[model samples]
Target: MPLLTINLNPAVDTVCRVKSFNTHHVNRAYEVVKTAGGKGNNVARIARSAGEEVYSLCFLGGASGAWIAKQLTESGIYPVSVEVGEDTRTCIAVVDERDNSVTELLEPGPVISQEQQNRLLDKLLDLLRSKTFDCITLSGSLPKGLTNEWLDQLFAELCSHDIPFIVDTSDSRVLDLLHHKPTVIKPNVQELESWMGTAIREENDMIQAGYDLCRKGAKAAVVSRGEKGLLAIRKECIYKVSVPKVNPVSTVGAGDALVAGLALGFINQLPWPEILRKSAGFGTAATLSYTTGRIDSGSLPSLVNQVTIKKIQPV
Candidate 1:
């Protein structure tokens, strides 16, 4: 079965390389690369690279949107695009080679009209009725003009279908939709801390937060800690995944790659340890490449093997 990914605020991502990257001085970029971007789109790309069929649903507008659609198609992902009036946004990331730092400039994206919002919902419902997907992933932030009520309604409708949902977003509004009980929620450590309104000072605190998310209606919570690897929390057990260190070229889309790996694992019914190991490997591999969302397929297996998974059974 194919996986379905939804990207509400997609963008054309431009990545530039700067040698030193001075704050007040004019910096020259030696290399520049552009690719189809957005959290959901990145998941689609990585999943497709792993030989899974993926369908990407998104709002597209103007020339940039058309280009993204074309690139997704060329990448072997089926695009289900809804047309809008405004052009899609562009995000720029400046990578400093000296210290491996990334500075990003993100646009607010287009304002989606009421009619467009309804059309997107209708399209999603129609697609659900027409095809069977292994899982549905809701990723990224909402664009302007989309309301919290609309998000609640979307979650309600999606839950009525009896399919599993994997949500990966930093938007705090997702806390409200947990009543609908999503299968999995992927949030970075910073995002989790923001949601909890407390700092995760220790491993125990992190584990407690994950369990708290479960009590709030999520079946499982996967917390991504950059460089430190991932922490997977479930009702019965918890997993701490550690990835092998590598010289990272870019950190863009690493979280999305981890989400993709989790989705793939769920789709294939793998054990929790293997699932987390693969997720850590995918995330680590993404950092080895300069392009956003792209991973080194050749090194994936070795990376997977290098991953260390520790499972803890909660008392």
Candidate 2:
């Protein structure tokens, strides 16, 4: 199955190690490493590593965006890109071993012109018309210039043709996209809490929220909780999956990994519980690796055994 990833707001991720972080203070960095990163870009990386054919569709503008395209090309991912007017964005994540928390600086992406947006969407639609994609994943946050109507617009195309889509996003936009009824949707605890517009203090609330989203039009809903693991609702059954203890270096891209795994599960037609295991497996595996969205596939096997499955009912 062909997997297509669309990154609307891409970036060059710069990582550095530091003893400590301080506000309004200059600090020396231990080392600097830059890589192609954006929520969608990282998801493509995960899908590629898992032995899937992926096409990375993104917009490149200025130097950083050019570097992103080059990185994708070198990594063996097919890049279908268009040049924009403004420069792409960059984010810096500083790892503080002393405090065990990373400090992040995020730059909002440059605004894209109307012509640029139309050109990109034209290509996407043209491709969809010509080829059969096993799955289309819309990952990451859309930049400011991208309108809220973007997801709905594509949803119309997919709904017209019955193409399955897996979406991982947050906030009001996510709710807005829910009306399109994507084939799969993944959200972490915090995102789910925000979506519910209420506190998710216990598992019952979490279960209800997942089911509620399914009722809201998601074909299947997967909710990820660090350590506590993943929850999913499909065909009127709720699967509660838990993972064994893990010492996480960071949790930044774990949810993305889960999205990739769930996408694989959907493509493979695995049973719901197996899908939960793999999703939890990949997510926990992501925590074992640091340096930004890089996952060690070797760790997945051991972690897979650590994943326990349970059938849950909401009260």
Candidate 3:
């Protein structure tokens, strides 16, 4: 079964390479690259690269949206988009190769209308009814005009459908959907800290926070700690994962790649340890590439070998 990824707010990501980026000064880029982006789209791209059949559902508007669709097609991800009135947003990422850092400037996407939001929801229901999918992933932030009440209803519908879902969004409102009990949730350290309303100062703090989230509704909570590695917490078990150090070209899409790996693992019904291993490998592999939301499939085997998974007592 294919993995369905939903991205309500999509963007054309422009990555510019500059030796040094100085604020308030004119800076020239040595190279420029653009690609389809958004957390869900990134998940789809990485999943496709990992040899999984993937479908991306998103809103497309104007020329920028059309370009994203074309790019997805070229990347072998089926784009299932709803046409919207406003042009899609563009995000800029300045990569400083000299320091191996990336600075991102993001734009709030086109404000969606009630009618457009309803249309997108309808399209999602239509697809869910028509196709057989292994899992569904809802990523990125909710666009404008999409309210908490609307999401509550939509999540209720998903619950009724009984489809396994993985949610990887930055929106705080996502916490409201936890009652529906998504199969898994991926949140970075900062996002997790915000949601849990506590400081994640160390591994044990993160593990406790993750488990607390599982207690609320999620079957599992995967907390990403950047280069520090990830902690996956379930009700009874916890897995601590660490990846071998590597020179990262860019860390832009590592989280999305991790989500993709976790989705694939869930689809295949792999053990939680294996899932953590795969997720860590995919996330680390993505760091080797300069492009956002991409990984070298060939490097996965070695990377997977380098991932260390330790089962710890649930905190």
Candidate 4:
């Protein structure tokens, strides 16, 4: 079965490398890379690289939108795009080589009109009726002009389907949608803290936060903690996943990579421990690549082996 990824607010991501970035000064980039980017799109790309058939459903407009579609097609991902009125957004990430720090400038993407929103929903529904997907991932921020009702309808429709879906986003509104009971909810440590409105300073705090999400409505919560690896929580058990340290090239899409791994695991019905190992492996491999949403595929096996998974007592 194929993976279907939905990116409502997609972008053309531009990554520039600078020796030492100084604000308020002209710093010429020594290297630049551009790729079709959006959290969902990244998941699609990584899953495709892992030999999974992937479909990317996204909103596109103008030249940037066309470019993104083209990139996806070239990447072996089938594109199911809905045309919008305004151009898609372009996000820039400046990587400062001095300390490997990244500075990001993100544009508010095109405002999706009511008509466009309906069209996207209709397209998605039609696709769901026509094709069967192993897993569907809804990722990234909601585009401007989308109303809460629109999201409600989207989630309602998704829930009506039998296929499992994962939600990976930074928007706090995810808390509001937990009642829909997505198969999994993925949030980074910072995103989880923001949603819970509390700092997670200790391992217990992190486990408690995961439990809170599950208690509220999420069937499962996978919290990504940069180099510390991941904390995966379910109603029955919790897991502490750790990956070996590596010199990172960019951490931009590591979370998305992890989501892709999880999707793949669910698709294949892998054991829970194997799932976390694969997910963390992909995330760690992503840190070895400079591209926004890609991972070093060759390093995945070794990384997966190096991943340490331990069952943690729920707080």
Candidate 2, residue 307: lDDT: 90
Per TM-score, the best of the predicted structures is 4
Model 1 residue 39 lDDT score: 90
lDDT of 4 at 279: 92
How close to the true structure is residue 271 of candidate 3, measured as C-alpha lDDT?
A: 84
Please state every model's RMSD to the true fold in angstroms: 1.3, 1.9, 1.3, 1.0
Overall local distance difference test of candidate 1: 0.90
In model 2, what lDDT does residue 300 have?
90
Question: Weakest 10 consecutive residues, lDDT, candidate 4?
Answer: 156-165
Per-candidate Cα lDDT values, in order, are: 0.90, 0.79, 0.87, 0.90
Tens-digit lDDT track for model 2 on 1-315?
777887888889887777787779997887787889888888788888888887888987899988999888777777788798788999888877675577889898888777787788898888787667777887877777776666578666665556668888774577766777788788878888787788888887887888888878888888877878877776567888989787887676788788777767766778778877887888888887775657778889888878999986644
**Superposed model 4: Cα runs more than 4 Å off:** none
The sequence of per-residue lDDT tens digits that candidate 4 reaches over residues 91-172 is 9999999888899999999988999989989999888888888889999988889888889889888867777789998888
Model 2: CA > 4 A from native: none
Each prediction's TM-score against the native? 0.97, 0.93, 0.96, 0.98
lDDT order of candidates, top first: 1, 4, 3, 2
Residues 99-216 of candidate 3: C-alpha lDDT, one tens digit per residue: 8788899989988877887887898888888888888888887788787778887777766666678888888887778888888888898998888787778777888778777877
Q: Which parts of model 1 are misplaced by more than 4 Å?
A: none
Clashing pairs in 3: none
What's model 4's lDDT at 121?
A: 92
Name the 10 consecutive residues with the lowest summed lDDT in model 3. 155-164
C-alpha displacement of 222 in model 3, angstroms?
0.2
Q: Can you list the residue pairs that collide in candidate 1?
A: none
